[model samples]
Target: MNEVVHTSPTIGSNVEEIVFVIVVVDSTDRERISVTREELYKMLSHEDLKKAGLLVFANKQDVKECMSVAEISQYLKLTSLKDHQWHIQACCALTGEGLCQGLEWMMSRLKSR
Candidate 1:
């Protein structure tokens, strides 16, 4: 899926904070696959996400045909994942359900650490 990156979003009262580029990818089924994180980790696990300042948001959780969060995580062998503390959640973006909380959690997770 194509994504448009949002830069310097005023997430809450936080002013001019650095926001990571958000890469959008499909929550897959039909076959097993690796997340971009895994791809990067295979290429360089020691170079953790902090080294690259990367964060992932695996979205599209409410599609009728979309895979469950566990399925996506397992198919990607997310246990092999590292660096970034990201995972999928059941969401209906069209309805604004769970998006804000997810975004807030992301902002806090990346910022507080």
Candidate 2:
């Protein structure tokens, strides 16, 4: 799993702020799930990103053995993030499925903030 950090320009704001963090996970790789979860925790706990929303792309959903979105969310302990805003999207990079929804969620989060 590759941890990706993305900063989007705030809506109608000139300054670019990291209103959210995106983590791209290889949903098919179950062995690395725990490590990925820990890495995510460390990243999100950083003082610089304490208030950042989380957007997780559960990649390789096209694969038959890939973990389901629910499974990924549970394994990542997303429910425990009561103070943070988050969304887990099941996506296939090959076909670009679920990408827009994730971005839209991020944008909504930014707007809400």
Over the stretch 19-102, how does candidate 2's per-residue lDDT look in tens digits?
688999999999999999999999989998888899999999999988999999999999999767899998999999999999
Best TM-score goes to which candidate?
2
**Which tens-of-lDDT digit does each residue in 1-113 have in candidate 1?**
59998788666784554434344446653442454545645543453335333333456676777767676566656576465555454555568666676677667766776
- Please report how far candidate 1 places residue 27 from its true position, in Å: 3.2
The local lDDT score (0 to 100) that residue 23 gets in candidate 1 is 41
Provide the lDDT at 61 for model 2.
Answer: 98
- Report residue 51 deviation for candidate 2 (angstroms): 0.8
lDDT for model 1:
0.55
Q: Candidate 2 clash total?
A: 0
The reply for model 1, stretches above 4 Å from the true place, is 1-21, 28-58
